[model samples]
Target: MHGPDVSWYLALSGLMFTIGAIGVLVRRSPLIILLSVEIMLNGANLALIAFARHFGHADGQVFAIAVMAVAASEVVVGLGLIVAMGRRNIELDVDKLRTLRG
Candidate 1:
């Protein structure tokens, strides 16, 4: 028997990416933005794995792994910046952060 088509996976990925993009654009909190970025990364990962499986190649999965590594680093850096701002007693709001000169 045949399995589900690749388009379904791609559609789901698109939906996820759209939601994440909206969250990133519409939210004001730094933590929320970071979470949105993570969501977008996961969507990309899902697409990559889906395509890899469809093509019967390991490259997509390998790239997904690399993407995951980069995503993790992104989270670490994003959280670090947020923590730094917190330590400095700066507001966590993105609009307020734009005034930061340093």
Candidate 2:
């Protein structure tokens, strides 16, 4: 059956996802990098919602909701750590978070 204009949405989401990934990779600030990761998650969520609306399936929508919840939890925990780092010491640089030190 013929469908809605979902290709554009998918393309836009793809671009957004790529941008977010690139931002995460290229950025030097931990805060910006975390926000970029969130953007990537949101991009995937947008695509899932579009597919759900286009294919008339509730599963994708449900999955999207789950992703959102996970993303929110991640934001809470991740931002708490960032704030903690900021309060305890200066950690504006992404490389400053050297948790995997030997």
Candidate 3:
């Protein structure tokens, strides 16, 4: 049986990306920004896999894997920084982080 059309996948991906963008723009917490970035990455990944399936090729899947790897590394580094900030009793708000400027 046939699955959902590519357009449906694209619509979902667009919606996810839009939500993530909005979260990043409206939220002041660094943690929320990181999560939103992850969501955007996931949305891109979904579009990549969907296109790969539509084209019957592995290239999109390969790129999606690469994106996932990058996203994982980003999360690791982001969480590490967040933890370090917490240990130092620093505010978690993104606006407050500007004080970190030398």
Candidate 4:
């Protein structure tokens, strides 16, 4: 059985990245921005895995794992900030958060 080609995977990855970029640029909520950043990371991971598969190399997979780790850390920190903002009764709008002074 044959699966979809590398081009298809690349196309999907590009589409996901584009959507994520648009969301990050247009969305005002911190939660939405975080989600969009996650989407972008996933999209890059997809491309890395696809290329790794195409080249029959383990490097891409290794990089994907590293990327996942970074993404997890980013989510942790971002969510922590959001929670702190919430605790302080601050608005969740990114545009209004020009200064994160406590």
Highest-scoring model, lDDT: 4
Q: Which digits, one per residue and each the tens of the lDDT, describe model 3 over residues 65-91?
A: 999999999999999999999999998
Whole-structure CA lDDT of model 1: 0.93
Q: Scored by CA lDDT, what does every candidate get?
A: 0.93, 0.89, 0.94, 0.96
Lowest lDDT 10-mer window, candidate 1?
93-102
* Model 4 lDDT on a 0 to 1 scale: 0.96
Instruction: Please give the ranking of all candidate structures by lDDT, highest first, separated by commas.
Output: 4, 3, 1, 2
> What TM-score, over all chains together, does every model reach?
0.93, 0.87, 0.92, 0.93
> Residue 72 error for model 1, in Å?
0.6
**Residue 2 in model 3: lDDT:** 100
lDDT of 4 at 54: 93
Give candidate 3 misplaced runs (Cα > 4 Å): 100-102
Q: Whose lDDT is higher: candidate 1's or candidate 3's?
A: 3
RMSD of 3: 1.8
Each candidate structure's count of clashing pairs = 0, 0, 0, 0
* Pairs in steric clash, model 2: none
Ranking by TM-score: 1, 4, 3, 2
- Residue pairs that clash (backbone atoms under 3 angstroms), model 1: none
